[model samples]
Target: MNSNFSLPNQKSKAILERYASSMSTSNAVSFPMVISHGEGCWLTDVDGNKYLDMMAGIAVNTTGYAHPAVVKAVQEQAAKVQHLCFAVFASEPQVALAERLKKHVGQDYRVFFGNSGTEGIEAAMKLARYHTKRPYFIAFTGSFHGRSMGALSLTASVSKYRKGFGNLVPGVFHAPYPQPYKYPRTAEMVLEHLEFLFKHTTPPEEVAGIFVEPIQGEGGYIVPPAGFMQDLRSICDKHGILLVADEVQTGVGRTGQFLASEFDNVQPDIVVLAKGLASGYPISAVMFKEHISTWGAGAHGTTFGGNPVSSAAALATLDILENGAMENARVQGEYLLGRMRALQARVPQLGDVRGRGLMIGLEFVKDPVSKLEHPELRDRVQQLGLEHGLILLGAGSHAIRLAPPLVLTTEDAKYAADTLEKIILEAASH
Candidate 1:
């Protein structure tokens, strides 16, 4: 591995200066590498240095950067017709993409297209309230739905994301999410907490929906206990509350299945998908059971939601995922999990390693027994990864997330595991 290249070389430094001056400070810029382009699982900065990308733009690029199939689909659709307001005119690409979503979901459902995951969350919120005529919603602590007012109201992952944005949308309650690694019987505790909330705080009859992530993404790639999702489904069903699954970071074969909820054999009343749906093209979909399609025309609409080019790109992405990419995620994910667990035996500071498919997290702790979070160590490892020609991102308080592109090869996976082992060993020593 070439670890000698200087980051923020002359060419990249010039662009970084321009970016600092032009862009908003709210944008989180983790590294100094100014990317010029990417192919497969690697990115090239303007300085001509290459880094293996493990975050996949926060799990956005399912097929990786500049996949030929996605490029061709976007080009062909743009050449014919680039934009049409789906609210007014029906586009073929948009209709076709919706049809494809129905098949993957394996249900008779209606799809609403938007430009982002937040928008999909917003749509689901609106639909839930409209269908049930309820004024309240329930979400989990350490869940990230989105940043818009309604979606923000449902998000409880980071305090900074909510700071200064006071008085968000009302009627949203938060319950604890089950983290089995940290606390045993977490599922039972969480379920009891929800019951307490239903009795003491939010009335079950007034609650419109319960929003959850199958595998918590931004909060940490934390997977819930085995029966947690099924329990949630039962709770929602008993109370006539819609169960909304925020699959933004875990969908599109990211978890070795089309939807992470599939692992538990549970189906949500509403499913939100984005991020990897279009290979980084900006598009999201809110799919709900057909029975809940009660809103009339003009109730919710977007001018740029179903862009033809993005829809075509999503269709192509789905085709690739269905063919073999999903299987590859399963195979490589098991391989990576085994490798990391083996390393954990020798590296006592690695408190926990948990994930499904490529959506994995490695948590750092001061000691294995106490499990005190070691955020500093996690941050240092992320920085050192950049120096070693590897790109990684941090999740939750003290965990490094690995949401690499679904196209990651066995060779690349092996290299990533080896490089991470080296970086962790160095970080732990310090």
Candidate 2:
């Protein structure tokens, strides 16, 4: 190898071209630039262009990129020892991180580590079924659990992800998520829908679990009607069905509180977490209540579930979240939402503004027909936003989802929102 050789171009466009030629196209649409670095709530492109990251790597970087504490912890852990088969020889980082998670989650809880959100869901589902001795599970529409076989079976994002994969792990039924902004239904109505499904479609007794998102993340950030979650909890209790909260995207203080369910005063039997748990580190866990802690322990495992390096990063990340990062997320998120609502007053395409904390969405719709999607306008706004040094994302079908990092300051939120408004105005004018 030549020691002094240099590459010709480092721009994002060139990198993308190479990526398209060499990588599998099924992964995802590539952004123009290959991101070189991130800090706080900003990302730097290979071309040295900086972007105010409104999406926070799809709601994964809570402490933001390269937080000093997380970096230091990872470095120290890596230098000491990195790899250990958790099943045979457990490490200190794993034990400490588990204890910390258990402390924050609840006293009567146990943790199961995995490498991603889907793995957590898989473990939770298996535990629910094994403990209850039941086969079926009740999931919700407009939900996204993960892309794995078991998790994908619960996801109802679109036919594209499920096509040709029919006859899945049978007995997964979907209930309409109580999206008040779009459905405009009361809590009572939502409960009625669930009751109807149970009575007509599937028996509640047969359902081992009722999986839900505390605040529907991929479902356009649809916050359930007040008391809807409590009602679901009651139903699950009455029917002996476990409640599994899919907090993969909304957990780790993305929703102001440590967990989104905290605001509703509702607790779940099992909670799945990922995304922001270790900042950007690949780590996830299925936190279960005490009663089902030892349900078939050897039945499930992962090779890199709780690697020491990721655990160290997670421990440091949790410290940041508990100290003051969650409060910052709450304050900045509220400020951003207020500004977005103000902008909505002027932009006719802004159909709705809804979310809690940093998990927010601005749904775009045609002026008269609210159900119709304006993806073209959404695409234009996203492109215009990038040109203005901001990044945005579209979720569900017709919403601009804003899931900025928890470390984003008030000023950063305002600037991102201002740039968004400008892009929307420019798109509307065109």
Best by lDDT: 1
Candidate 2 lDDT:
0.85
Off by over 4 Å in 2: 1-10, 368-371
Error of 1 at 363 (Å): 0.5
Q: Write the per-residue lDDT of candidate 2 for residues 63-167, one digit (tens) a residue.
A: 888889999999999999988978777999999998998887887888889999999999999999989999899888899998788898999877788888877
- The numbered model that scores best in TM-score is 1
Model 1: how far is 362 from its true place, Å? Answer: 0.5
Q: Give the root-mean-square deviation of each candidate in angstroms.
A: 2.5, 4.2
Error of 2 at 296 (Å): 3.8
Alpha-carbon local distance difference test for all models:
0.92, 0.85
Which residue pairs come into collision in candidate 1?
A: none
